[model samples]
Target: MANTKSAEKRNRQAQKRRARNTTVRTTVKTALKKARETIATKDAAKTPDALKDAIRTLNKAASKGVIHPRNASRRIARLTKAAQASKAATK
Candidate 1:
C-alpha cells in the first residue's frame, strides 16, 4: 500500500513494533491479573511473589516504551495497597 520505498520500510518497522508491543502488553496484563487474583485469594505464600512479578512486568513495559512510566507507577501503587490490605486482613 505504500507508494514510496521509504514508506514501505516504515510500514514494516511499524508492524514489527506492533507485534512486540502486543506481546509486552499481554504479559503486563497477565501479570497484573495474577497478582490481583492472588491478593484476593490471600495466599500468604504467593501474594508477595505475585505482586513483585506484576510490578516488575509493568516496570519493564514502561522502560521498553510500551507503556507510560507514570501509568505503571500508579498500577504498582494500587497493587501494593491491595496487598497490604490483604495482609492486614490476614492478621
Candidate 2:
C-alpha cells in the first residue's frame, strides 16, 4: 500500500528495524525469565551468577535502545531483590 518510492523505502526500513528490535527484546526477556525462574526455584548457589547475567543483558538492551533505561533498571532491581530474598529464605 506504500505507493510512493520514499514510502516503500521507509516501509522496508521499518520492517527491518522491527525484526531486529523484536529479536533483541525477545533475547533480553528470555534472559530475564531464566534468571527469575532460577531464583524462584531457590537454587541459591546459582542465583547470584544468574542475576548478574540478567542484569548485564538488561543493561545491554537498554544501552542499545531496545528497552528504556528506566524500565531495564527497574526490572534489574526487582530481579536482584527477588534473587536475594530467595537466597535469604533458603539459608
Candidate 3:
C-alpha cells in the first residue's frame, strides 16, 4: 500500500529486517526458556552450560540491537540467580 517509490523500497527493507529480527528474538526466547527449564529441573550439572548459552544468546541479541543491553543484562542476572537457587536447593 505504499504510494511512493521510496516508501515501497522502505517497505521491502522493513520486511527483510523484520524477518531477521524475528529470528534473533526467537533465539533469545528459546535460549532463555531452555536455561530456565534446565534450572527448574535442578540439573546442576547442566546449569552452567545452559546458562552460558543463554547469556551468549542474550549478549548477541543486545549487540545486534534486537534487545536493549540493560534488558539483556537483567535477564542474564535473573537466569543466573535462578540457576544458583536451584543449585542450592539440590545441595
Clashing pairs in 2: none
Question: In terms of TM-score, which candidate is strongest?
Answer: 1
Q: Write the per-residue lDDT of candidate 2 for residues 7-90, one digit (tens) a residue.
A: 999999999989989999888888898898899899877887888888998999899888999999999989988887887898
TM-score of 2: 0.91
Cα RMSD (angstroms) for every candidate in the order listed: 0.5, 1.1, 0.9
lDDT of 3 at 78: 96
Poorest lDDT segment (10 consecutive residues) of candidate 2: 44-53
How many clashes does the backbone of model 2 have? Answer: 0
What is the Å distance of residue 49 in model 2 from its true position? 2.1
Q: What would the per-residue lDDT of candidate 3 be over residues 1-91, giving only the tens digit for each residue?
A: 9999999999999999899999999999999999999999988788899999999999999999989999999999999888888888887
Order candidates by TM-score, high to low.
1, 3, 2
Error of 1 at 50 (Å): 0.4
Clash count in backbone of candidate 3? 0
CA shift of 48, model 2, Å:
1.7
Whole-structure CA lDDT of model 1: 0.99
TM-score of predicted model 1? Answer: 0.98
* Model 2 error, position 45 (Å): 2.1
Tell me the deviation in Å of residue 54 in model 2: 1.1
Model 2 CA deviation exceeding 4 Å by range: none
